[model samples]
Target: MMFRQLFDHASCTYTYLIADPVINAAILVDPVLEQVDRDLKLLDELGLTLQFCLETHIHADHVTGTGKLRDIAGCLGIVPQGAQASCADRYIQDLELLELGKVIIQALATPGHTDNHMAYMVNGNLILTGDALLIRGCGRTDFQGGDAGTLYDTITQRLFTLPDTTLVYPGHDYRGFTASTIGEEKQWNLRIVGRDRDSFVQFMSHLDLPDPKKMMEAIPANEECGRVSVVV
Candidate 1:
């Protein structure tokens, strides 16, 4: 298995490339629209055929590259089962496994940041927590059907139950930190460490974060699987 983490500075998004070198097949997770060329080049240089472009959820920050990548590479577009992506070629359900050679990706429904968000666990040891859990902080539960209590339950009940050593690679990272382990976060993540459900919900309600800068344009485009014409 081959894995690479790519970053988009503009939106602070993290796009992951996971592949099975034996079969030369790759899947891009939470890709950014502006980084399509870069991702394509990387895939080409790696001698891999892109078999899937997967989204964790319908994003409200950056438009996805799935649609364009699908058009260019003829790969299927996959999204979480309840994501409002009409153009997705497939909707992956909870605990469903997507395999390429020996690599297996399992979809875990961790809906709180968004009503239909998902986190992908790869090979049982690594997790791609798409906005569900961050390094120290978690995603804001203020919009897109977000609920603070639900997010708390997801972190404590679902994700925290994983092996303490499981690697956590988040969808976006504003801080310079790259990755963290489930044990580290479980012990140090201030957002969920000692807070109960009600307290966590109350705390999240007071964050008062502003919407993402691209929210106005990103949501609708993401719903269409990143198909939109820019007026440039």
Candidate 2:
């Protein structure tokens, strides 16, 4: 397997490119529109064909590159079923397995940060936790129908249950840190470490974060797979 973690400094977004060595069939998760050229360059340099672009949810911070990449790479776009993104070629269900060459990526429904968020389980060892779980802190649950209790349950019951050694690759990280493990997060994640559901809910309820700068544009653009203007 070949793996690369690409970052968009502007939005603090992490895009993952994973490929199977046998055929160079690859899939990209959480690609940003501005980074399409860079991602395409990487694919070109590696001689890999993009088979799919997977979106965890309809992001509010930055526009996703799903449609552009699909048009350029001739790949399919997939999002969680709950995202209500008709622009996607298809929507994945929980526990559904998507195959890229010899590699299999399984989608896990772990909603909280958003009503339809999903974390991808890849090859049994790595988890791409979109925004449900971050490096040392979890995603803010102040909007998009976010619920703190659900996020708490997601962390403790769904994500924490994985093997302690499972690698965690988050969707976004403001800090420069790269990756963490299930055990590391469980023991040290400030938001979920020592708090119960109620406390966690209370903690998240007061975040008071300002809305994303690009929300007004990004939300509508992203729903159509990042087209600045959707004709249809």
Candidate 3:
């Protein structure tokens, strides 16, 4: 197993590459549009073939590189089954496993940040948590189709139930923190620390975060898999 973490400084997003070196099969999770070239270069240099592109959710801060990477690698673009991303080649449902060489990627429904949000588990050892659970905080439930109550359940019932040592790789991290264990998040994440659904909702509603600067542009582009105004 081989893993690489790529960070996008502008949006504080993280993209991950998990590969099975023995079979030369690989998958990219939550790849950033602006960083596709860098990612491709690295993949080329490593002599690995991209088998799939996995999206944790549709992002509002930055467009995803699913479509671009698909073109580059002729790989499948995987997104949540019910998600509305236009470029998704494969619609993933709960517990759906994608077999790639020696690695198995399983999708876990974890809606909170969005109704169709999902988390991917790799070989039951690592979880790629989209916006559902961050390092010290959880995703804000103030956006479209976002519900605090749902987020609460998703975290406690679904994610927290995983093993204590399960590695957690989140989609975005404004702070320098890169990764953490499920146990650490369960113990320290402020959003879910001893707070009930109503209280959590109330707290999140008042956070007063500035609207994502690229929301207007990024959402549309992401829906189409990072294509600009013109069709490729």
Candidate 4:
């Protein structure tokens, strides 16, 4: 198994490249439109074929590269079941496994940041926590059908129950931190460590966060698999 974490500085988004090197097959998770060339170039350099481009949810921060990559690389575009993206080639349901040779990626429904979000657990050792759980802080639950209570439940129950050594790779991080362990987060994550469900809900309600700058453009575009304008 081969894994690489790529970053798009503009949106503070983390795009993951996970591959089964024995078969030279790869999957790109949460790709950004502006960084397609970079991702493709790396794939080329690594001697790998892009098999799938997967999205955790419809993002509000930056446009996705799935549409373009599908057009260029001819890879399948996969999204969580019930997501609004009609352009996806496949819809992955909770607990469904996508296997690449010996490596396995399992989708877990963890919808709070967005109503259709999923967190992927790779080979049962690491999890790609897309917008549902960040390093020290979690995603904001103010829009796009977000529910703070659900988020709290997701973090404390679904995620925290994983092995203490499981690695956490978040979708985005404003701070310089890269990754954390489940045990570390449970002990130190300021957002969830000490707060109960009600306190967490009340606190998230008062964050007063401004909308992502690209929300208007990104949401509609993402629903169409990141096409700036739909053909129909």
- Predicted structure 3, TM vs. truth: 0.96
RMSD after CA superposition, every candidate: 0.8, 2.0, 1.7, 2.0
Candidate 1 residue lDDT tens string, 198-228: 9999999999888899998999999998898
Off by over 4 Å in 1: none
Tens-place lDDT per residue, model 3, 1-232, is 8999999998999999999998887899999888889999989888899999888888888888888889888989988977877667889999999888888889999998999999999989999999999999888878858888899999999999999999999998987899999999988988889898899878888988888988888888878877766322
Clashing pairs in 1: none
Better of 2 and 3 by TM-score: 2
lDDT of 2 at 142: 77
lDDT of 3 at 106: 90
lDDT of 4 by residue, 97-196 (tens): 9999988999999988888899999999999999999999899989999999999999999999999999999999998999999999999999998899
What's the TM-score of every candidate structure?
0.98, 0.97, 0.96, 0.98
Q: In candidate 3, which residue ranges exceed 4 Å CA deviation?
A: 230-232
**Steric clashes per prediction:** 0, 0, 0, 0
lDDT (CA) for every model shown? Answer: 0.94, 0.91, 0.88, 0.94
**26-57 per-residue lDDT for model 2 (tens digits):** 99999999899999999999999999999988
Residue 187 displacement (Å), model 2 = 0.7
Q: What is the lDDT of candidate 4?
A: 0.94
What is the lDDT for 108 in model 4? 97
Clashing pairs in 3: none
Q: What range of 10 consecutive residues in model 3 has the weakest lDDT sum? A: 223-232
* Of candidates 4 and 2, the better by TM-score: 4
